[model samples]
Target: MSHTVTDDRQQQTHTPVALIGLAWTLVGVPLAYGLYNTVKAASALFSG
Candidate 1:
């Protein structure tokens, strides 16, 4: 009887830089705008 051991690494897939940037921009701009508006509105509430 003989036993053999194999060592191997799994392959990794990656997202492209441009695609990642586009995804962040798509999500981040709306999020930033919403946050800015919320802060602006909240300030008015506190000012009263």
Candidate 2:
């Protein structure tokens, strides 16, 4: 019988699903609305 093993670093090369989801959200929803929420939330969080 033969056995195979994989390395951990190779697993990180795949694209993340969250980023794809975010892209879909940006396109499916209104441009202004999506940008507005992202900008608003980010600014609020980082307004030092």
Most lDDT-accurate candidate = 1
The list of candidate 1 runs beyond 4 A from truth reads 1-8
Q: 2-45, model 2: which lDDT tens digit per residue?
A: 99886766544777999999998878779878889999999999
Write down the lDDT of every candidate, Cα atoms only.
0.97, 0.87
Candidate 1 deviation (Cα RMSD): 3.0
Clashing pairs in 1: none
C-alpha lDDT (0 to 100) for residue 30 of candidate 1: 100
- Cα misplacement distance, residue 33 of candidate 1 (Å): 0.6
Q: What is the lDDT of candidate 1?
A: 0.97
| Candidate 1 local lDDT, 1-48, one digit each (tens) | 999988698888999999999999999999999999999999999997
